[model samples]
Target: MSRFALFLALPLLFHVGCGAESGDEDVDPLAGIQIIGDDLSDIPLRGASAAQVARFKEGDRLFDFVFRERDGLGPLYIRASCAGCHEGAARGPGAVQKMVLVEADGVTPAADQAALPYGNTMRPYGVGGATTLVQPEDDLVLKLSQRLGPPVFGRGYMEAVDDAEIERVAAEQAARGDAIRGRINRVVFHSKKNADEAFHRFSEGDENLIGRFGFKARVATLDDFTADAYQGDMGITSPLRPSELPNPDGLTDDAKPGEDVDVETVNAVADYMRLLEIPKRAPADPRGEALFVEADCAACHVPSLRTRADYPIAQLADIDAPVYTDFLLHDLGPDLADGLIDESASSTSWRTAPLIGMRHSTSYLHDGRARTIEQAILLHDGPGSEAAGSVAAFRALPREEREALIDFVRSL
Candidate 1:
């Protein structure tokens, strides 16, 4: 059968069963069931050759690279290395950081927003001298702050996800008349060429795209994000990003002129992240799986999505992807909005984070505010309020059942 046909028939075959009555006996809705066929945890990392491994080792090295005053590790920046922010067990992309700002400027740190109530993961390293390098004439005084985040794992498949599948899931949600709606976060592909140039040239009328990376979904691709991190996070400058983050505050000589880092190093780090394998699931997570589905979490946290036939990776080719996400942005209600708007996402809208490595994560939510999975589940609201209700129903289940749901998440 055609893939489209199969999708069209799913609602009929898997009817939305009636919600259990308030005090009914608990039933296992997903017993002996197998829905998705793809295994995202098994894909191999490219560039693992001996030399590649050597470079990967260097990239993984905690913080040996040096920065110069001109090369931009900040008049103001965040952590010194990717490892600094993303460290520790159970640390994935949803890491948290805390920073305090006493005054306001044109750009407010993401954590400082009164509405958001989270902390900013500020850069620990600086350039020039660690004090204000701004001309004596300028009257801007900003304080240095600190915040931290967890490590990100199993992200390659997340990037490998086909855009079309995300759209299909959104269409399905709209068709079902469910309150939950997921939207893709559009991002700018700065290097994307337009048709007029030997490569394509971008014109004024061309539609600006949505970013699919970062906490706010501001970056587009892993390569771009890596380059950005080199410049913004670590104070390194590459060919792609020639300028350094300005250092109005002269904290170290590293921020002085003519300080540039090698681009190949940055690429190597990105390659390591891209090739890092997804963690495997454990055997004890079946009950959790059942509860996950029964709680209607499957509506947004889709279990399987098939990759398109024409992708570069041979392993990912024609496989059923079980990353457990629809990859669409949804309005998470007033409580979650950051007041910062992107092209396709509103302040309240956030991408449905892929749950490929949830078991390995300590923090939850975009800002990493929820310390536990249960807290994160309870925080769901707005379009996802229905799913939240379903979760509450699952909580009412016997402790074993609840544990099963958590086990299932850990298994993933």
Candidate 2:
């Protein structure tokens, strides 16, 4: 049994081992302890309806519930539950290492993945007699990248942003003539959606939609994002993505036959993501805010984007979301490139990471290699990087000014 299975079974053992009278009551020793508000990363959005609150609670429970082999955890898997990688709805220690065959330059991806069949994702664990794992071969692999799971808070507002708004930002950047232009990541929709889902609808025969989620901006909506994580990370199939990923033994099914989870569960999880609120910002230094904009850091990391007027979530609709991302793809140049192509995005291209909860993070950047915010900023000065101009401006600042800017960003 997996650790999660053991955890879930502990409650049953307690119930069976002890028989307390219905009238018996035990007093808690620490019931009067006051709650501290330091960690509000998993709280729901302001002004949520009672019904919305109920759904958020249900989704919260499942997000932390761990699945075992009998629950279709994996013939192959990564972490066991949503919370495995995103503990407390924030960045956890879980990391997925992606490897692929690249060209001689060690930057561009190979023409095809035929040489390495298990695909880019390298699952670290296996179950149900499938012991072989996809480890990187030194001779075959040209490059490898480690991606840490991002926080899920305030995602509802990000998902609610209109495609037109994303396009508007892209167009403005293109017109600026500053090598900082960003483009949208158009991707195919693979998840089920309600007919009246509040999002831009694609015309008949058009499969491409603007993507805003994921490192390369590959996932278009919260529901599909939830479904993809369930299948890809946990190896649990759902109606939206019913097929199991390629495994070593060529196994087509797991311990649980057919789909492991139902549509209701998927929707519940997505709704929970939609209702999560971004952590409130601390007071910003006026000088630092001005310096941040002057240094062009705000070019790709736009301070705010307005959500659609008709967003399904009442609390999230028609508001300026301070996510600090334009949700467009930008090439950070060769030094930061992971050498793994993702759909339309090249190896060096990445979506501008949001800065809503930077104060709570110990690591920075897509791979979490930068231990400090200053180090992450210096990395933007890589050769041929789009943020070169911004980094240059930041370097030109006085020592005190630079420290001020860093403090403002950390307080975000």
Q: Which candidate is the best by TM-score?
A: 2
Residue 392 of model 1 has an lDDT of: 65
RMSD of 2: 6.6
- Residue lDDT tens for model 2, 130-233: 85455545467447667877888888889988778899999999999779999899888876543124444542234678888999998888888888899898
Off-target runs (Cα >4 Å) in candidate 1 are 1-58, 62-72, 88-125, 130-150, 191-210, 246-259, 308-310, 382-389, 392-398
lDDT of 1 by residue, 258-283 (tens): 43555465556655555555666656
TM-score per candidate, in order?
0.67, 0.89
Give the RMSD in angstroms, all C-alphas superposed, for model 1: 15.5
lDDT for position 68 in model 1: 33
Error of 2 at 70 (Å): 1.4
